[model samples]
Target: MSGQATVLVVDDEIRSLESLKRVLSEEFEVICAKDAGEARRVLESEIVHAILCDQRMQHETGVDFLKHVREVWPDPVRMIISGYSDSEDIIAGINEAGIYQYIAKPWHPDKLLDSVRGAVQLFRLQKETETAGIDMKLTPERVKRVVTEKRGAAQQLFDFDRIVHAPDSPLRDVIELGRRAADFDISVLITGESGTGKELLARAIHYGSSRSAKAFVVENCGALPDELLESELFGCKKGAFTGAYQDRIGLFEVADGGTIFLDEIGETSPAFQVKLLRVLQESEIRPLGAQRVRKVDVRVVAATNRDLEAEVRAGRFRRDLYYRLAAFPLHMPALRERPMDIPLIARRVLDEVSKAYGRAVHGIAPDALSRMQCYDWPGNVRELQNEIQRMVVLADNGQLEDRDLSPRIRSSGAPITLRNGHGNGHHNGHGNGHSVGATLKTQIEALERLMITEALDRHGGNISRVAGELGLSRVGLRNKLGRYDLRKGVSRDG
Candidate 1:
């Protein structure tokens, strides 16, 4: 790459280096280095956004040179152009060099062009993230914020685990455990409530594992019908079913050598469960009505909000399969259990949401935050995330205030249970009759209405989002808003 990027190609082969120069010259200022020593001189002279290095070199292995580059001058996205795809030494280079992409040689020009473009995109995003500050650490509150801004604004696909991975706090241990869990080729079962981040953990395991190089696919088991779910999970031969117009590779085959995440895995029916069990046990699957079984080396990582032990006891799940899937079980802590992490999590989530939405949400105000810590998150992190995303999207101003929080949280002045010295939990706060002289439910309801009204006003009366956390439909939410007669004069967008 020359001028703007000044790319450096390091290879002992003249033809390889020359061909690259020709392809890259029109787009970048091309610089050539025949060996490691020459590459060093080129690196010292220019700032490169991308590097295309050969796998073999006389003075040093391409991986060793890249490893050195990583320490001394870590610029540009690193790639290995190698013919030896099966070499252990080449694999060693992959990890050591921090290679962004690997191009198996005799390379095609189109693929090379695409790889460079992808590398450039990575470089630009890294630069912007550095300048814009995208630190990946999820305190409970931050995850709550992200739940609100799901997939967030700019349509940016971020490494969700990275959000929890970058922090230096006690949560780092949790993040590391998640990373290690991803490394296994066996089944992984993540258990957590609605918002506790089971899917987030699943994504982390996929990205931090060897499967990071392959497609990390996800499907909610409960989201579709039995036949649809089956079709989605396993590929079908043409005319296998009525809708099977063409032969399609199932997620198991599509995600070969990678991980296929089955979210809400417990939701699958008994018949569907049988198919899943066979896949796990045999590492092979026979498509519907097909006589032959196909072997798949895919990793299975499943998550559920429900307890499989209960499902097994109830005859809803297979006991043998339960044992197989829970080879490694990861329990994601609820947001309430990790209250100390809320402030940080909320800030990180808001930062990401603001950046994604192109808004200027500085952070959650401290006083508003203090009130947020008291309420129990029955729906867990997912609830918090949804609320935060709703508020961020609905927020009338840059600062997220107490009034901007969900009504359930803002109206949490009612009595709540606290642990006693005897280790029994009892109602501590007043006004709810769970305690003496408890507050009226009517009063709590009023506060709830007020909180919802304010969030709706801030969001320009967006019913879909206001109803999101409440688990109400848009039409139902609209009725509530109408009852409150929530209205606005000045536009939040302006």
Candidate 2:
């Protein structure tokens, strides 16, 4: 063996246990357990590659115990040893439990060693597949596209640099605070509305930290069910569940030496919150179906759009976990909150989109830029990116103008004319009441809602036609519909 793979031997007979250990220790690291109970405890603390169990132990049969192992710790290859029983029962039990091999008593030491080596090789292959899938799933889309090269010491803070903003950007203070927080190894909780760049800020903190040289992994807590979320964060044994064909590595283990960004932390269930609390309290994780807990050194940076404090007060989020995650809380300001940054953000996005689309969109016309600045961006930076990409693709004369701006943006807060020249369609943003003396933000939102509502009604809720008639991408239009709660009436099938 190139490396010493740990073997766990379970036998009630002390003499037999000593002999097995003596023989196996030469080529592998051997740990002895007198019975099933002791074997489980050993497994909880150490990573064992294979197990050799005497079929006729005192309290429990080896087959019975191995069956249990298949449920909670199935990663280790199992072998049953007993010159005592060649019974049909024993053979059936071994087959059902998925034992790697059946060893007879008075076994040859050389053959036993060879079987264990093969088992170890099988274990290695299973782990490789598990970690490979985990690595692929955990790579964030932004990281795949934007963070292409590794950053040197000088470039460690470059994530923050990619956060293009104007001189008078409201996020400047938040960025400063995040940079300061990155110096320490404390947990950080970033709060904001959707598309407000919470994950972007989390990345900045990771790269700005001392662990910048290590891996930075991301997991969307809300994207998976609670059961799966747990299994993904803490590894699982082979056969731990349906579809678990191989031993798996979790994100926590993958990010052992670095940072794990848990996005949508507020959306996780209370049960999962308790599990996460344990990881933060103790720097260790017990993989599902595995007997032991493994120590991990990881910095956590969690992000959520919800008001966590309110969630805690309302009993939706665990208070203890909330405090643990918010040790250093940072807030990402929405696009509407810092409308001055729109031009700067828009231009940067335009440049990127132009290059990507192979277009000649050099800049935004003053009228188009003015309209963007005046309109309230419900989807924040992400929406701006979509708008800019659309402009770049449609920029026939090299510059985006008012014509390139979507109907919703250009006419927000402007008077709407019905067929009979009546001004009606405006409501209190939520479609309930009139907006007489509403703030600019509220008035713009009201107008946007009215436009979408009228479009949906006109097209009989046909999203494709509505998006085209309004000069908005389908995705952009869908996001608006969701933001303004207009989807309840719209029908995609229509």
Candidate with maximal lDDT: 2
Task: Tell me how far the alpha carbon of residue 249 in candidate 2 is from the true structure, in angstroms, after superposition.
Answer: 0.5
Off by over 4 Å in 2: 1-158, 413-494
lDDT of 1 by residue, 390-447 (tens): 7787677778877787776766643232222111223334333232332344323334
In model 2, what is the error at residue 185, expressed in angstroms? 0.7
Displacement of residue 91 (Cα, Å) in model 2 is 36
Worst 10 residues of 1 by lDDT: 416-425
lDDT of 1: 0.66
Q: Cα lDDT of all candidates, in order? A: 0.66, 0.76
Question: For residue 160, what is the lDDT in candidate 1?
Answer: 44
In angstroms, how far off is 459's CA in candidate 1? Answer: 37
TM, every model: 0.52, 0.60
